[model samples]
Target: MDAQPDPVGEPAGSLDPRAELSEFLRTRRARLKPEDVGLPDFGRHRRVPGLRREELSQLAGVSVAYYTRLEQGNGRNVSAEVLDSIARALRLTDAEHAHLTHLAKPKLKKKQSGACAQQQQPVRPALRGLLDTMDSVPAYVSGWRTEILAWNRMAAAVFGDWGELPPQERNWARLVFLRPDYRDLFIDWEQKAIDIVCMLRMNAGRCSDDPRLASLVGELSVKSEDFRRLWATHDVKEKSFGVKRLHHPLVGDLSLQYESFRLTDGTEQALVTYHAEAGSQSEESLRLLASWGTDASRAGSSVRRTA
Candidate 1:
């Protein structure tokens, strides 16, 4: 099948939703097998990997030509029912299902001038206060571009002092790919790195015109071979609740659960909070770290008073 061309009159760096949707569908289809989906294999030689287009179409209860059109990026005004059927046939996770829907129906692009005028807004005062009050949990607010907008003292204590870095250097993707220390912090560094890039890819799909995000992706692609390889895979994922295993310089190995809450206000910022299970060794480590952070703050204040 011929590949779909880029949308006419679109800029070189702008995203093509149709192309994205096609690639996403193709890749997902490539990963499945006939046996995996409870289909019989007749030992027939196949030219391509995974289930054939006809097989997928049969499983999805759609005509092969119709399914092929969707996979080829020619299906316009695709109904939700069809998408849901396709999603079930592919056995997609919740995150993957949502991503498929986003690709199928991307938001209408805002004018370039309006988008360019947009800037990262400040975290609300109440939200800042909320972070301050969460002394026991390490929490931070991140912009849609994964920019570290605001972090609490506990967050600083756990994840280095992001405030010390320049605004451009405070991004999650930059920290993972550029900083050796941050890369070493995670136990599963390779997987963690891939997830970071995947999340960035998802962001790119949603806000392709964001100059800052585009610049960051370009910089990383140029600097890090790992980032370049992963970005080429076209993997996309949204950050959700998960367990993180990390080795901090001060604290030892810690296994923490993180939950991300979306802010109701217009901004797409999310409040990410990390906590250890009560009575677990990780909880003890967190307590020690919190105490150390508190003492360090007190000492700094005392020195300022003495001066």
Candidate 2:
């Protein structure tokens, strides 16, 4: 990451993902004071902490001036040597180290939509087949980026709102935070939003360099202040399986447990299916919802596509 700062903006259309990742890492590091990490926080009234450029330089075993240049994105040749030392000084976990390495590496300049980029949206045929077969349960396939690729009839019933939403707003995660109807649909709106935001943040980190992901982030950041704030926290958690409580307009309050499995052969989409404990009142409610969703799907059939 060594080079003089490009004026105005990236000579290309936008800022490099490396630039964004670097900024995030620097901000996160600078936010922590020495005392926050058990070192003395005695600088009285200073700028930032955890480590100053000089301190980080010492801890990372690199020269202060050189580190500064790297931070400034002027160090065009930041080898693995510097990154490894920096990770050690930051007490980074394995995942963090991997993310750091990703940030420092050269951009994958291949076209964002191509044979290699197939994983970006190539929903597996097998997963799609599974979704169709699971017409009895609320099931759908979505990629990490929260795209509603494909869903069974039952999926539409439980998440009926998605069926009504235009293509631009079919995102369950975004609706959970910004849509008025969605906020009121869940009895525990606050918790639901938090979980969705956390999951979305995790996906964003996993696909930070993706053009579609960048667009999604920009849209959500502009549309919801809550989304913007949650995103800044940098929390990452995969939400594959969980129990959710929702007050469906048609089926009343119901609890459903969902499980997600990543598809290996087809696309990078995850197949998520929601089920209720057999013989329980919640299960009965889910069945009713399933029936209603099936009826609706018949009236307005649309194929779900996942990438």
Top candidate, metric lDDT:
1
TM-score of each: 0.83, 0.72
10 residues in a row with least lDDT, candidate 2: 1-10
Runs with alpha carbons beyond 4 Å of true place in candidate 1: 1-12, 107-117, 294-307
TM-score of 1: 0.83
Q: Which portions of model 2 show Cα errors greater than 4 Å?
A: 1-15, 49-51, 54-61, 74-76, 79-85, 88-96, 107-122, 187-209, 277-281, 291-307
Write one digit per residue (lDDT tens) for candidate 2, span 1-307.
0111111112213235456465646765776667655566555776554467776777788898888777775535788888899878777766566555544553432322122233345455666677778756888776655667677777776665354555556566667766676776678887777777766654444555555656666777888888888777654455668888876666578788889887664444567788998998888877665666556443322322210
Report the C-alpha displacement of residue 186, candidate 1, in angstroms: 0.8
Estimate the overall C-alpha local distance difference test score of candidate 1.
Answer: 0.75
After TM-score superposition, the amount by which residue 84's alpha carbon in candidate 2 deviates from its true location, in angstroms, is 4.7
275 Cα displacement, candidate 2 (Å): 3.3
RMSD of 2: 8.2
